[model samples]
Target: MRTVGNDLVRSQLHENRKWYLGLGALLVVFGIVLLAALPFATLTVIYIFGALMMLGGIIHFIAAFKIFEGGYRWFWALFGVLYLIAGYYAFSTPVKTAIVLTNILAIILIIAGVIRIFNALLFRAFQGWGWTLFSGILTLVTGVIILMSPDAPFWVLGLFLAVDILFQGVNYLTLASYIRREVPKSSAEQ
Candidate 1:
């Protein structure tokens, strides 16, 4: 499948720039708060994750019975059960869950980074490919560090999370500004 680019997202969003600014500001504020109260925030994050996992498990459990056919149904049901147990354990012991989550995050980041770098190389002729390559290198390094030192301080994990939020906020704000500047042009083109 083709990846949806900025043009697609830009077309889908409303022309109202205010919403973007508001959301970006909210995310930045939350990031700041999380950074300031890292320990509590980390715990809070774990709790939220636990809840989501539980919800996913419940949904999967239902799907197993409702949608799957014959033998495949058992697999989904088993998967759902696993999710439920993991979610329950996460809720019961958030600290331990956070540690596990950190390792999982590291693995995911590494994979994502490799993908980004490969794509950046493939599209090196395009503008901003260098940025993608740079970002991917940073991501890969962060993941490698995390993987190597899985027992790093909770604060480090918290800092990473905060940085992610801050970057996301900045990106949103930038996109919002760009949209604001191009609103008239976009409207005209439409």
Candidate 2:
């Protein structure tokens, strides 16, 4: 039997269904646009990263003098200089930076995949272990493919981001539709 609280909850959901659907549609559109212009998106990310690194270096430099002393001050200053040099290199040669970043990501993923797989094995007695194993294998495969491909670094990040956004949008749309379908109807309406 449906309770008054259930009906109220359903009504609330019904009221917000349009907002969910609208946001989902907007995200879907944005994801598609980003996917279409992937190279530009990739470069945009690189440039943004470069800018952030530069900003971080400046902050470190300021902190060194203002917040540190002796060896600590020298350490922060050195760190800041390294950051600035790295940031400048990134900005000056984005393609090389992307390649380096992509390789690092691939290596990390591979290591994580291996670790997850082992963890899943060690915890095989637990529920959901199979899912963990599956995820590990999938992650491993993705990393291997990216590492092996000659040009994967150039576009993998952009493609992954586009797909992630697309899936999130789909999830929102599904939730909105589910809410609409689940709303309780009055006896007369039923």
Highest lDDT among the candidates is held by which one?
2
User: Where's the lowest-lDDT run of ten residues in candidate 1?
Assistant: 1-10
User: What TM-score, to 2 decimals, does candidate 1 have?
Assistant: 0.66
lDDT of 2 by residue, 11-120 (tens): 67777889999989988987898799887667777887889889889999999999999999999999899889888988999899888988888998899899989989
Clashing residue pairs, backbone N/CA/C < 3 A, model 2? none
Off by over 4 Å in 2: 1-26, 164-190
What TM-score does prediction 2 earn?
Answer: 0.75
Q: After superposing candidate 1, which stretches have Cα over 4 Å from the reference?
A: 1-15, 107-141, 147-153, 185-190
Model 2 per-residue lDDT at 138: 87
